[model samples]
Target chain A: MGVASTALPRGQTVPLALRWRRLGRRLGFLCGLAVLLSPALFVFLWMLSLSLKPDVENTAFPPVFIPTSPTLDNFREVFATSPFALYGRNSFVVATAATLLSLLVGVPAGYGIAKAKAHGLAFVVLVSRMTPGLSYLIPWFMLFRALGLHNTLWALIITHLVIGLPITIWVMMGFFEDLHPELEEAALVDGGGIWAAFRDVALPLARPGMVVAAILAFIFSWNNFVFAVVLAGPDTRTLPVAVFNVLTFEQLAWGKLAAAALVVTLPVLLLTVLVQRQIVAGMTTGGMKG
Target chain B: MGMTLTSAARHPGRPARRAVASYRRRDKYIRFALPALLVVAAVIVFPWLYTLYMSVQEWQVGSDRVFVGLDNYANLLRDARFHAAVGRTLVYTVLAVTLPVVLGTVAAVFFHRDFPWRGFFRGIFVLPMMATPVAIALVWTMMFHPQLGVLNYLLSLVGLPPSLWVYAPDTVIPALVLVETWQWTPLVMLIVLGGLAAMPTEPLESAVVDGASPWRVLRDITLPLTLPFIMVAVVLRAIDALKAFDTIFAITQGGPGTASETINIYLYLQAFSFFRIGHASAVVVVFFLLIVALAVGLLLVRQRTKWA
Candidate 1:
């Protein structure tokens, strides 16, 4: 009876105050989160709103946060005016070819370097990545023209290797280092050659790393501007160049511009959202570990 | 034992042959790495060397090539525009890198705490880093409009006067840096967050148990431990900001009276617009050296502060 009487008042008074404090803290956290995220969210939302709204609403004073009557006319106008489909196809081809080639070559190189501990070779490859795109562009432009490869997808594919190959090598190197050598050694002990060991054991193990490398390479190639701007002709221009052309040729049609911008970014955005964990893992490990 | 004894009696040279075979196998890594190295040599190494060759010769469109040894470098040394571009690049890099590292560290610490839907919020935060730069530039160009843009409207709401975002000569670099900060701060945050996640919890808990304040623990423990990661972010950001082109080219094209022209923009104009190939090659070499030097400097600092 004494214990029950003691517990009753304590629970009644203390629990109420404690719950109120917890509720207040929760509210404070939500507010801080909103404030932190608003800027990043605002830029994207504003672009989305501009793309959906008509021209009149887009340029209105006290800018509209939400579109009153969103329409697809702006998107229609963009597709009608530009060869955006062709540009998209060109980008896809270049990015895909570059990524595949980087994997075919860079994966083995990464494995070799990791196994052999060829730090000098790895550093050389990194320097290639760090070198400015423009440094390679002028010479590549002349060489391609001389070889009649300029204004073709071939040129873009070859040039994009500068971006894709290093990333592939670095990421694959990190992955391969993490893998124990015992499995490959066991395969070798069974009279399998080095190539067989790699193919049978390490390659299968490094598949996820290859995926990460391929995605990063493709995204980078897709986003490339300097090489395309210098080398690409009217027929070979990629999506980024197409977007830039929209601004130069068209007047300040905010809706159309926003529409064009969203179109180019959509694929990468989708990839990022879908594989965010992989991408983050790749970025941190690829960047920091090396 | 009987079969092994008979085989050994029949082939005494087998051991010698195996030694030779194993020796050959030791160089197998070279075979695997050859294709990538050859490709890199053809595409990157050779091209850079060719650029070095071109830097010594004056070549322009519709004109005969002339070898002008050291003339281009000499011109670069005295060129006021080149000097200005270099200065602008350094300033922009500093502004961009410092702001992101600082703001990203804060954001990283904030996100380190447990909150509802933290993963969802983090995904939203990283969207900017993934978006295409040209598209981002276009969107920001519209938003930076002096008269009808929402930014000014938001500013007015806070009882502050509207200012030119990317239009004015003096405001253009800072304005561009703002966008760089917005897009890249998340990268720094992610890197630092990884560092935080990997850090041990024992020290922090003991400090808390010892009645140390949260602020003190953060300053004394968290920041010091995360410094290496922060340095990594700084180096990456600096390198990128020094090479930034797509957004600035799209937004201003180095306009407002050449106030925003960085080294990349200037080099582009020199090589393409003016067709001064040799001069532009010289600029490329200088820009490359600057990057290498900055990287080395930052790496040294990182080495000094590196933790296990």
Candidate 2:
């Protein structure tokens, strides 16, 4: 009671019925998020501006927040000079394939662990997830080279699955544990086998879990850089690696790089924003009850 | 086929049932596990074992591996760069974790109740985490461009001269830190927001009734209750920060000097670029041990808390 009431910001001098403080509270909250969010927003605005400005204005002494004359030339240059479209396609395909593969492996793994009540296996999986990607990259580089799969799209997809699968399994394990077992049991009692019970009963209930897993899996795989950097060849290079390649080719092409960055960032950014409410709910549920 | 026939002949119905049941279990195990085991073995388990083997050998590109146990580990122990990398890694982790928690929690508390544009703000702030870090790094690198960079452009507004950002070794780590914080603070914000939303409001209400101030309530009540979630954020961020490479690689490439080089970057260069495979493996082994120790420490703390 003390804590809740205290949080409401009341003063003895001001009457309890005064509504000004509530208005102040709302303004203060908005202000707080503004401060918290400005750094990121500034980045987006700056990049957007950079993408528009001509190369000369890009280096103007007082950096222009608004391009005096915005141009689509940088966008045109990106397409004309680089394999940007191909890279986008590659990233999309690999991310999608990896997400699907992770779901296939992860759902069952999560289910088994949840059913068996194996915290040890869960911990083991988390440890694997925690292991730095680079720690495994070098050896895998050698292994993939030996297998002649290095520099292939297959390698990028598989490597991303390493990132995607564990999170899917971990998050879904927490989710599955929260689900009622009675549904599956009822299906089994109705002459369904374990597979059929899981497919028909548990799977439907697990839709939200699947959505959360798929979203997070896609995001991680799509943004993955280290794996693609090491494994992808010229033909298989993903967007991030492709952008990095451009940076190397023309050092400090600020205008072009910003344009390219924004182009690549827009799709995922929009998707993340659209699903953020569900994502937050998923995260909260997983964290609180896992 | 032979076993089934033999079982049918030996014990009729019961033996056949037993044979089939065991076979089914075996088949399930083999079918479900073999492919997974093979993938994991080939990808994870094998590399780890191979890295251990590599660490004890005098191996380099195009050279036959020769056994030289402990030398690589000894070399890493004596290497000043390794020591510096360890220090940088810790500093990066501490700054990255602490700043986000404090700032994120404060924002979360302020925004705990309903407010206009809350969803929009939350969604936009989380944009950095969703986009590729490398791409963000690329953009920020340009933003930090000595003359053309927005950072300096802003600094000039405060009557300060333009400063080198990515170009200076001293500023490199801090620059990377800023980028990391921008990207990850939203994540912490989400966690803290969730924690705040879930918090019992009754305590705060009673505190207000007793005429206690907002400051007092936050200090005496809210912080203590949200400590566990904050700790979880710290642990997660620490692990991620320890492995920070992509953004740094994209931005400065551990440059101006090795100022921004974490253990991961050090290992990457030694193993891949220079082909000091043994030394790199040794570095990885040490890193692995450190992470294990941290995980164990967290477990012990969790157990102790439960005990209490």
Candidate 3:
């Protein structure tokens, strides 16, 4: 139908011009998106090629754009030679723990701040986030050393909380503002306390927003290298820091590094796809109304 | 303002009662705000203050702390490496901010209208932002590998010699910027897309009816409407870009002759690798000032634009 509408619009000159204009706009939009997306697509396809190629073929001069002898050797190596699974498990524990902790502190905090109309407190949190990580890194470095907490997972989780908590709280503040206070008030009127009102009414309704916040926070904590790098002993190193070790130790294993990179990203990719809607909704919600 | 709020809330006959009530409320706020404020101050403010104090000292690994006031800052001022990091950081920030904003705005506009495969396309485009930075850096490192990497492979296909990418001092910052822009452009796109999605359709419809070209309408209508959202994205991303450490650490560890060592990486090296805690603290203090200046400047610009 679209093609027919654009095809000369038989016996109607005016309609034809309008139809052509619309067609032009559609074509332009698609082309623009394709151009914008090329960099992402290019890198993705390249990684796929490297992941599938065998080790020798990976280094073939005029390097193999496609695997002629595709194998799982690199993935197998990533698993067998290193503690890839252990690192992945550690990442999961740290990320999940950090996200849950942030939500615990941040959700109530976000609610209290928003309900109380504490814009000053909100601004204070923003300023805390605005302070570069290094400012805290130095002092915390000293404090953790003095406490003998250096190179411990506890240090990693706590330091990451500082980074992830504020962002989660701030984002939740926006989510909380969009919610109707009437629901919580209704719960309170039924003799529910503040905590109960949040638990049964606000929390249930805020599931989508919470999911978005949790996923983003988890992804960030999972990917955080600085805290993990500084605080994690070799026994506790997370995947990101582990992958970084590849650069220093394995100068020749490009394929293995690529495979390791893919392994690290697989979980976040799945989560991003799953929560894509909530995230995009959360981001664009305010602007569309204003 | 406090007095006015209390007066407005009070019955005319109860003015004195309201004043005392409001004073109690103010007292309550001061009380409730104290603990949170203390946590923030200890976690944030004390570190910064310590950084300032340590910056002036000449302490190093196992060395006596010499009270060298202003020496670290002075040394930084004369240091060529410090100058290079500052220059590279500014360059990276500008490109990373601008390219993403412009491209993201365009994407937002194009995707604003309904179309076939719209949902699929939207999800696919945001995939890069979902992919962690280390993953993106690793993938790009492969693509940029001088030998046996896809980027070089493609270059060979085009009859061009392969480049060293991160290893080449001249190319390191640009290479880092490329990876960053790749990872973050989707973020800018998502924010702009939100802004575009939120924009009212009436003004745009009227502009079209009045025979404004799409470009003119975009400039006068859509651009102005989305300026706040765009500013928010730019400022927030500038903060992150200024503190960029992850990908650089993964790919180069700020090496290949200090080509990619940002201020954040420099601070890390000083405090941890080199154990120049005092000097590193000074660098952190300086870096904080730069970030504060950028944030304050942006906020002021935003306020002025709003008021105007």
Taking the tens digit of each residue's C-alpha lDDT, what string does model 1 give over B179-296?
A: 9999899889889988898888889777766766667888999989888888888888888899999899988998787899999999999989998888899899989999999999
For model 1, the superposed segments whose C-alpha errors exceed 4 Å read A1-13, B1-26, B114-116, B304-308
Higher lDDT: candidate 1 or 2?
Answer: 1
Model 3's DockQ score: 0.34
lDDT of candidate 3 over A1-290, digit per residue (tens): 12222333245568768777778867876677788667777787777778788767777776767788778888899899989898998888888888887787777676666666678788778777677665688788787888898877777777777766776667777777778754554554455566676777777777777877787788778878777777788788999888888756777687787788888887887777776777677545422221
For residue A104, what is the lDDT in candidate 2?
87
DockQ of candidate 1 against the true complex: 0.41
Q: What is residue A100's positional error in candidate 1, in angstroms?
A: 1.2
Taking all chains together, the TM-score of candidate 2 against the true structure is 0.90
Residue A1, candidate 1: alpha-carbon lDDT: 14
Local distance difference test, each candidate: 0.86, 0.78, 0.75
Question: What is the alpha-carbon lDDT for the whole of candidate 2?
Answer: 0.78
lDDT of 1 at B126: 80
Q: Per-residue lDDT tens digits of candidate 1, residues A1-290?
A: 11112223334567778667667766776787887788888998888899999989988998888999999999999989888999999999999999999999999999988877788889988788678888788889889999999999999999999989999999999998898665665566555688987887889899999999998999989988889999999999999999999988775799999999999998988888788877787778765754
Q: Which residue pairs show collisions in model 3?
A: A288-B198
DockQ, in order, for the candidates? 0.41, 0.38, 0.34
How large a fraction of the reference contact set does each model reproduce? 0.57, 0.45, 0.44
Model 3 TM-score (2 dp): 0.87
lDDT of 3 at B100: 77
